[model samples]
Target: MGYSPSIYKFVEGSDTPVPLDMDVVRAVLSPYDIGDPNLTVMDDGRLQCWVRAADGSEAEIFVDEVGILVERPHSGPGVFAIVAELASRLGAAVLDPSSGVFFCSREAHACLPVDMRKDVIVIEMTGEGVRAALIG
Candidate 1:
């Protein structure tokens, strides 16, 4: 099986992880064509998904009270762009639990080669967020 890395993204720079509105995420992610035909929040109160635009890679992007979770086969540039934009707008960072990295900005994610992308990196948060360090 593939690594199928799952990463969480959170808005930073606050004492608490900012809550993510599933509706906002739904609105922002409209372009991705995530396999949710109805765009309805599931009974679990999260978005369940599969990515059709990424060569049928089984992927999911969901939000909870604290943040967003993304599970995918691997990193794709197109997907990264969308996520990066989301992060940029929200002052968030993608946290890769597998590897202690926080992709600080959209450019950070864009520069990393796809095959080398095990996960997202962390950034520094002030009022909101930005993660740019590696953790053990």
Candidate 2:
């Protein structure tokens, strides 16, 4: 499960983004540890999972022809689904989105413009989970 204390920070409210790699990102993920690891694409048009974990959440990863554009967890049942949907629309990945908190990869941050990222609030992750209402 993606649970790293250093990965997140709690400010006035909302989750702040920190620099993290795909491997470290994969390691902290809760779903992957269980066996339901999120899928990553290979060059040959085949499928290779990054980290496997367990969860009833079902979904698949899709990629555009080029290989740079990735669409993963196409659909699923959970908070992650909302994230996937949003990312799909934005052509990005769900780096972090728990309740009121919304942390994204540095790439994703750049994908979104400065104005948009500025609007996002920062909240600290808590044991109970992020409080979604803070954003509103």
The CA-based lDDT of model 2 is what?
0.33
TM-score of each: 0.58, 0.29
Give the whole-model CA lDDT for all candidates, comma-separated: 0.49, 0.33
- What is the per-residue lDDT of model 2 for residues 22-62, given as tens digits with 9 covering 90 to 100? 44333334344333455454687543343221434432333
Q: For candidate 1, write residues 22-92 as lDDT tens digits.
A: 55566567666555565647787776555443443334666666677665533434455555555655555
* Model 2: ten consecutive residues of lowest lDDT: 2-11
User: Model 2, stretches more than 4 Å misplaced?
Assistant: 1-20, 29-41, 44-55, 58-114, 126-136
lDDT winner among the candidates? 1
Steric collisions counted per model: 15, 26
List the lowest-lDDT window of 10 residues for candidate 1.
127-136
**Candidate 1 residue-wise lDDT at 77:** 43
